[model samples]
Target chain A: MTGAAARTRALALALAVLTLLPFASHSQFFVNLAMLTAISAALGQAWNIAGGFGGLTSFGHAAFFGLGAYADAILQTRYGLNPWLGLPAAAAFGGGAGWLIGTATFRAGLRGSYFALVTLAFAQAFGVLANSLDITGGGSGILVALHPGAGRFQFTDRRAGYALAVALLALATLAAWRLSVGRFGAHLLAVRENEDAARALGVPAVRVKSAALALSGALTALGGVLYVQSYLYIDPGIAFSAERSVEMLLVAMIGGAGTVLGPLLGALVVHAIADTTRSLITTPGVAPMLYGVVLLLIIGLLPGGVVRIAAVRGDG
Target chain B: MAEAAPLLEVRGLARRFGGLRAVRGLDLDVQAGTIVALIGPNGAGKTTSFAMIAGFVRPDAGSVRFAGRDITGWVPERIAHAGIVRTFQITQPFAGLSVAENIRIGAFLRTRAPAAAMEQARALGSELGLAALLDRPAAALTVAGRKRLELARALAAGPRLLLLDEVMAGLTPTEVNDTVALVRGVRDRGVTILLTEHVMQAVMALADRIHVLAEGALIATGPPRQIAADPRVVEAYLGAGAAARLADG
Candidate 1:
């Protein structure tokens, strides 16, 4: 099949799978698995906007993730605001933070490994600040009241959360697809490849990168909001963890950093492995160890990620 | 009939790199619908001047105006948007992208719609004799293929003024001839070109006016024939041998 046809088929398959997800045999287990997969896919898609398309390998994306979770938690628990209202708010916060980080560093001509370090530092600092803050519930975290209703976003059934997560993931995927085909997408690719050349060709490097990073952050924050909503609690350690950030990157990187479907495939593969390993070995720490080893093997084999491998195959 | 105004005007443009004056008060003009060649000895700051014009380098002194607008110290993207696009000495094709996709990125500027961009890219590829190679990966292209890719990419941008830096540097004679033809075709489409080249034959054939630089200064500016005859230009570019040949002609 042609590449476009293959992409279309893959997309159709993903949609079909997501549609049938709520009806699967293992209702509770599959719901949890699908929710995790959706969240991971959404986060990975978000990261791909900057890290994949813009070639800004961010190691600090969890800052936005944590921000979204905390923003939702703080608003719901302390102020009695609905989690729904916090969705857009979290997106805005994430986008704003991304803009600030992207501009300050990109304007100073930091990229590649250096840019990654700055992102890492930002996440670390945010984590530290979150831990030190009294109003933010410190490291102990904030609790969200679980009222099984549409208004509260707390559902008695896991299917509802799974469905919502799927919706968010779908939206993220659609946005990624749209951006990857538009003028902004072209500029992002140009900046990713050669900033000087892109600039010479009229691609505003700073603005494009900043916008991409902001979009990435916003999408990531949206996922975070969903995560906290589903869980009904948030803590600095869970929300602002570097390991969480690495997980996000792994999903995007292992699939293909730049392509729209990379993160989704990565999430599917990762979640499959995690599920299989958890089911087979009922042992502690083995699952995480296996996950790490699998990630390393994938990275070693496909340095550019599975999406790139697919692209190569498609080209051939 | 030539009242469209110069596309670029540089006055006393200068730049220094940590106590070294790389470009010193250079003045130049590139008129609309003309091909101007900048020829200079190595380290005479030819590429630096191109970089400044393309806004890669900030001028320490003087003004740069694009199409009668003061664009001094403007950002590179803004300058490019203002219709001044540049090519590198070495092509920087996105290795991961197909040749068609690379050109499609350039064509994105002409129209925001993806369909329109693809159409523009297809048209450009056909014009550049790259229709057959469009689907190929840019990194897989040969050297001459890269030069073509570079031109196709720059042309795809729909630039009003194209800055070509050593595009013909490493081409075979046949490829050089083809490139010269390609450039003329591009010029015929009404895009002004400012090319920096070491190839005297291509410069003589394509450039409407020649500007010879020596030590970051414009030593001579005139038609190719007049430029070839200028003592300073001949001395700077060629030695007494070329000067004698020009004098005899």
Candidate 2:
């Protein structure tokens, strides 16, 4: 079989194994780490669609993540909507946010570092809005009710969070797989490589990038839904925090930017390092500082990410 | 009716960058199935004229008609979608992608299926003498290989009109001869061609007719023999002595 087909089968097998994780007798801390890893993978995959494949590098994915969290929490608390409905609702809010930001930046011909900075600024702005907004409960944040059942998307068994996280990772991984094999994905990559050449080839550069960001935003937002459901609470500081954006980027960058499983591998590595550092050092800000050093090291030593070492054939 | 309008028509097309008139009042027509050449000295605005026709640069004050459709001010993607595509003077292949993937991107202009696009890309690559190198990254290719890859990519789009910009800028004589034949084969496929080249031999060998420009204005337009004999065209290149030297050597 071709590399892509082999990779697909491997992905299916990995997901199958992850699906059974909840049934194992793992400690709660291990389960939490597993859940966090999967969440990071999903978020990384979502970002990779735009930044890795489409070359719409963003530093503000926390905007969509926070939007989804608030959307799900507010819908359940104020509007009496099911947590299940929040999936689509949160995705819409994320997609709309993408559309709003993409239209403004792309139309003005922003690209490269400028585009990255704009995303960072947008994330910070959203964080401020969430901090002050009353509907989001201001600085205090909001909480989901303690309703435990599959119907409510909440579970009494805490291990269920890992299972749900795996499901999200599968969805995002499938998205990356589809992107690698699709014509639109080819066009998006071409645009990423050279916009003028892509335009000359009949690829609508701006529209393709905008669409990529919207799809990525929607997918990233799904992780937000899972977050509130798992923790039963979310504050702007946690939801729209700049660190959340950094972790998403860190995961994708460390794994492999454009490959199908890059983010998954990256998430596992990043989370493992994070948890190890947290345990080793009780001092505040030390773990994040290490992350910064690691990011710089990765950028300097292995620009292609950790997955490149494992790739037997070209990722494309 | 009157010979169905030319595949491309440019009338009074002009562009200026500050005080420098990059291209001005440029008028040209390319008939269907014909390979037309636009030759000029350095700074004669040949590349700028191609950009205007291909919609990379909007003309300062003029119109562009392609197959009878006035396409003035249209974006590059829109113009390409309308069946007109241009190759870059400085080859802009996706450097990290394989030659097949680069051509496949052009093939995607017509089809949405990855299999179909790859099939087309494969066929086009072989036809352009790039079959052996299809699996190699574009960056690894030599100048001649990149030039051929550019041609194959543009052809894969199934363009009705192709604007070839300096496809043979730097090449040995044998490579130039091969490219000339390839371009002729392309015209046989019924795609109209408009090319800008400094390579006089290729221009003389391939162009059905030649248009000579000097300082953003057409100095002469005729068959290759007639264009060679024009004193103004010779003057534009330099003195008669240098012109003869360039034409022969």
Candidate 3:
């Protein structure tokens, strides 16, 4: 097997083992951490498809993430629908939001830093809207009662939640792998490298780009749905925050943008750093500031990101 | 008497950017299995004409026909779907992708299954002398290699007609010879070709007929030897000695 195939097989085995670990060990805190890592990694992977492959870096994916969370929250809380069914509806809303943003901005010709700014503005706008809306629980948020059995998708034990998140993470990774090797991935990368050349070669620049944005948005939404369910809570500040969106982007960028396992590695590093920082720092805000400094250093030293660094060292 | 339809045709093609006519009232016909070269001075709208024909630039007034089907103002994808493919002046390769993968993308337009596309890409890659670079990142290739990769990719698309924009640009003389041979090889596969190049020797050596463009219009059209003798083409377009070189070739 090639390196990529070998890595994939290893990942599959790891996930298979992980599914049984929760049942074996049944540790709540470990379960929580595992679930959190998986969810974050999935979202980061989603962002990588467009930002990394399509080279349309977006700081606004939180809009889709928050919308997905809120859509599920509203449907289940207000309309009394099941969370399992509501997930797809939430993802669709996320896709629509992606389409709307991509169409308006790309047609008017937004690119590079300017494009990033536009996405940031949209994310900010979505956050503001979420905060002001009453039905969405506004800033105060919605709390759901935990039902800890098999089908409720909620668990007091936390291990089942970890297993669910692991499954989701595996799915997201598989998707990223397929795309990186597939025709759409090649076309998107071509667009990223040179728009004019790609267009001249009969690659549908607009439709392919829009489709990438939508796919990224929907995948991120899946992570967001799992996030809301695991915590059994939803709030505009938590879900739609600019910081959260940046966190997702930062993870993907830090790991490696175009590589399949970059997001997962990034999530692992971020979680490890967070844990270490919490132990060292007494102040609440100091940890995030330290993370920011470290990110800046990483960008300065390895702009292609850590995955590239590892690839160069032949570690990956 | 029955006459064969042109493999590709452009009629009344005009593109105006506000006040300037980049391409105005341009018409072209490409016969099946023939190599037609469009030669011009810089800023003479040679690339612009190719862009309009390939559907990258929507003409203000014009229709493009490929394989006898109207493809006027269609998007690049739709035009490509109609069996007309174009290569760029500056070779654009998917930088992070491998050579085989890059060609696979072009082949995907013709096939539904990924496996079939890969098979076509592999065969095309070997034909284009890119079998050795099949697993290497496209960015790692030299300029001449990149140009060849682009050509190979376009050919992998199974184009009935190909519009090659300066594929010979910046190539070494030896590379140019190799590229000319490749172009002849592609033509042998029954793909009609329309190309733009400043390289007189290569074009004269390869093109069955040559069209000279000066300031957005066709100034002259004839065999390579005849175009060399045209005074208007010599002074207005191909400089003094360029005509002599064409004559020698």
Best by DockQ: 2
> Where is model 2 more than 4 Å wrong at Cα?
A1-19, A281-299, A312-316, B1-3, B239-249
**Candidate 1 local lDDT, A139-258, one digit each (tens):** 888888778788888787888888888888888788888877777888888888877777777788999999999998998898889988888888888988998899889999998888
**Candidate number with the higher TM-score (2 or 3):** 2
Candidate 2: chain B TM-score against the reference chain B = 0.94
Ranking by DockQ: 2, 1, 3
lDDT of each: 0.85, 0.88, 0.82
Candidates sorted on lDDT, descending:
2, 1, 3
Candidate 2 total steric clashes: 0
Cα lDDT tens digits, model 3, B1-249, are 016888878888888887777877888888899999999899788988988888878888988888778988788888887888899897888887788887887888777577888899989998889889888889899999899888988888888898899999999999999999999999998898999999999999988888888878788888899997787798766476776677689
Task: Name the Cα RMSD for model 1.
Answer: 2.5
lDDT of 1 by residue, B102-127 (tens): 88877876677888888888888877
lDDT of 2 by residue, B110-156 (tens): 98889999999999999889999998889999999999988998999
Give me the candidate number with maximum lDDT: 2
Q: Which residue pairs collide in model 2, if any?
A: none
Model 2 root mean square deviation, Cα atoms: 2.9
